[model samples]
Target chain A: MKTLETTLRSLRESGRKALVPYVVAGATPDWTHHVEAAVLGGADAVEIGIPFSDPMMDGVVIQEAGLRALERGTTFESICQELESLETEIPLVAMTYYNIFLHYGLRRTAGRLHDVGVSGAIVPDLSLEESDEWRAASGDSDIATIFLVAPSTSRTRMRTVAGLSQGFLYASARMAVTGAASDQGEGERVVSELRRVSDIPTYVGIGVSTPAQAHTTAVFSDGVIVGSALVKIILQGASPTDVESFVRSFRTALD
Target chain B: MDEINAMGQPDHRGHFGGFGGRFVPEALMPACVELEEAFRDAWSDEEFVALYHRTLREFAGRPTPVTPLPRLSQRLGLRIFAKREDLAHTGSHKINNVIGQTLLTQRMGKTRVIAETGAGQHGVATATAAARLGLGCTVFMGEVDTKRQELNVFRMELLGATVVPVTSGSKTLKDAVNEAMREWVTCVADTHYCLGSVMGPHPFPWMVREFQRVIGAEAAWQLKELGVDVPDAVVACVGGGSNAAGVFAGFAETAAQLYGVEAAGGAAVTSGSPGVLHGMRSLILQDEFGQVEEAHSISAGLDYPGIGPEHAHLADTGRATYVAVGDDEVIGAMRLLSESEGIIPALETAHAVAWMVREAGGRLPTGSTVLLNLSGRGDKDVAQVRAMLMEES
Candidate 1:
């Protein structure tokens, strides 16, 4: 599997803005198909969620998606098994809270993800200071560890997060939870600040749902991550066609 | 204590013997780290400790007398002294920790405070302390709890704190905690999350325990003054286990036994499996998939699915014994205490009383003195108890 940095760097060289889509791994019975659909729809990479019971960063939409996924018996182990069976060209980074990794044993989880051809992890709850163990584990397994920087982040801390982050710096578009509307100007400023601090590729996530929002975010950062909007589609049991169409729209917008 | 011991517990990362760690989102980590530093700095500082005691003594009415339950003790044929925490201002032991945290909030230069409440005791305490300290306060309550404890909602509002009725998952204390943590993340710059319980990520479990240790310290000292040695057993009800942990801290290094009574329907320590919930790795009621399950109890305070990591550590090492008591037993204990000693304990605290009553002759020695931490007054629960009795009739 391609590393996240390799994927983003290639996209950067092509002068093509990255279009990363997100889908919860076991949120629906046909969850894997949604990823394939996004891939078919021209996604550079995908963020797959390992559903957690208490998703503090997520808003109602993603939380409901998590509930549905968990009810369908989605677990880290199960999701890993399914992802292992998949054959995707681009990196599929796992997004989840720290408890899942902590509970599963950090080294074991990272090793399992690596074995499954997973490229990286975005543990939103694990900050730089608390990420030493996870980072070391990821390092041993060659799985990139991504860290998030919010609009509220201090410049010094932003530099610290950028230094610790491996694959890319995830700049949260706004202060609110996922699914909230992203303020374009505020988000662009955060992305610009992130670019000034880090040489790593930056990706804006949280609240970049619509084609316009995703395009606007891509204009500022290396790319944009669309989660809750895609989650809503899967929650409604939409066809892979619907998922592809959604991603294709973003792809068209970015082009 | 040296910085080594301080840093050791909930160590640099907040683990209490494989429990308690920072399990919050990255957005909240900086704040959690800052809070931990401030807590450590304040804990060792003589001035902070002195100010905390002064606030407790002069403002919140600490050094509450330890009253012997002569009538009930004689009837049960076991000596029992009730640590009258209910007599403290705000009518519960909740005020102690709230005061300490509010002071810490000010010390951190944060001018606003937020807290989660189950039964509204913590909400009232947080609101009361915030009002007294001239800090903005917002207390999140589960929508269901607002209906169950409407008076507390009013009490918080009267104290100038906004009570947000959370309409989220479970519609109870757990949801309130979720919402409070979310809000704290958005407003971490100038607000302190005055966590009502000793649960949650690092610093919270350790910080809350330090704030509440005064309960045991005073009780131990008071018992000594009364010419009574350590009680055979120190009993306190455990919800998030603040009172139990506090009282246990006093008797932790002693030969005295510690008994923690949890509401039977929500007995996390006794019935739960080891899992992470509410930012701490403690014993939690969860499914095999590690998804937290909803806990049930007539006493809202005890309706939490998780206990403090310290309590889990204490139970694991056999330093303390935890038992679950039914709602009927809590009601019976409440009535028994009210009739026998004219002290109506809160439904939450009644669980401890019920435990003592059930094990009076069985586990405890016939003449052994058992110190019960009367963690709160029952005035808020009179209506609930009356309704239950009415339903029974």
Candidate 2:
């Protein structure tokens, strides 16, 4: 597996913006197929979210997907093993909280994910001050540690986060969780400001449901992230083909 | 002295016939060991004691009085005294523990303090400590609790503490605990987990009890000055058992009969068995597979699946007799105390008053003195109490 740094370097060299597709692992019975379809639909990297009982920052759509994933008993280890079996060549990122990571030891979890060809991780709840332990434990595991930036974040904190973030900056489109509709005006401002401070690539997330929002976001950042909308599509009992079609449409809009 | 010694060994680890051990995860084992060592060292350090006492006196308003319940005593035909912890700073005994723990948090070089609260009493206390110490504070409260105790949430916020509503699990105290523990595990380097009660793992129960022991310690001295060496009985409500353990710790060596009253939501003690709930092994209502069943009680504070480990040990050693009071009985006792004594007790404390009323009617002698730990004031519980009474009426 390529390191998160290497993945970013390659993306920058090719002048190709990275596309990160987030899907709750085991949200449906055939999640493996859905993940494969996401990659085929033009996703450069994939974010496999481990479902937790209380996803405080998730919106209704993502919450439902998380609930379905949890009911399916898709544990951290199980998700990692499933990702390991995937034939997709795209970099895989595991997005979860410190609880799941804490339940599974930091080093062990990071090491296992790296062994499974996972390229990076993003823990929304893990603050920068608290990242040192995880960083040390994930040492040379070749997995990137991605951090988030909210509009409410101060310049000083953003600099600190950018310095610590190994892969890219997940610029939250709004002050709220996933699924809330994004405001393009605010998104543009946050993206522009983050670009000034963040040395790494920035990806805008939260509420970029339609192809239009993704296209608008692509102007200011390396890429746009669509989480709640994809989960919503899967929860609506859409087939893997339907999800892939939607992703392709979104990718085309961005291009 | 004999009673106190019988309650536990001379070490602080033992409290009046109950055993306290450090049962924790391997990751937290080192922190617990360090805390135990620090606590021991601090206890012997005169400077530490002096600082603790000064803060207790000036900030926490220590040495809360024992008020004689004249009207309740007249109605019940027994001498009734209330250990008035309700008058303490923050209107509850919770502040006592928070003050001590916050000081320790500073001593440990932690920059932030995190706590989990059920009814928001502990959250308010923790916020108070954080404000006084100028430290960052985060309180995890169940979403339901935040809704129910919106005033306290505002109070915590006004005190400069961030109140994070936990929407997980049953969306109550237990889930708040889980969230706080999760935060602690990740932020242990710069945060102190200010446990609300004598629950959770090892040092928390022991440490909270020591801090709360002031309740019983002051009450014992006051009772002795009044020429009552040993009261006929001492009663306290048991939620996570902090108040009961604190009050009981003082008379552990005395001949005074100790009684812990639990919420009788289908008779918790009589119907439950020894099982692990939360992080400690205690008497809990559980299924055959050891899955903990939710406990039902009108009092949110007492609506816990398990009692504290020290309470379990006290029950096991027979140092304290355990009893459960039903919701109806507790409500009746609350009314009786409010009408007769004009002191509104918390629903948790009403459980103990109910037990005293029942025992005094059929068992106690006319001249026998009974002391009840009025663990908290009923201000926070008035709305709930009114709703419960209206439902019954």
Number of clashes in every candidate structure?
A: 4, 7
The C-alpha local distance difference test score for the whole of candidate 1 amounts to: 0.86
Residues B1-393 of candidate 2 have per-residue lDDT tens digits of 123554343244322233334333222434555666777677667887778878888988888889889888988899988999888889889998988888888888888999999889999999998999989999999898899889999999999999999876677886787677656644666788899888766667777888788888899989888777889889999888889988998998888889989888733455677643444445667554233456788888887776777777777778888888888788789889989988989989999999888988666678799889999988888888888768878
RMSD of each: 2.8, 9.8
Model 2 bad stretches (over 4 Å): A1-255, B1-3, B7-25, B266-268, B363-366, B391-393
Docking class of 2: incorrect
lDDT of 1 by residue, B265-346 (tens): 8999889988767787789887766677888998888999999998898888788899999987888899999999999999
Clashes of 1: 4
Per-candidate chain B TM: 0.97, 0.94
Q: Which candidate has the highest DockQ of all? A: 1
Clashing pairs in 1: A125-B25, A125-B26, B10-B14, B10-B15
Q: How many angstroms is residue A4 displaced in model 1 relative to the true structure, after the best TM-score fit?
A: 3.7
Interface RMSD of each: 2.1, 10.9
What is the DockQ (computed on Cα atoms) for candidate 2? 0.04
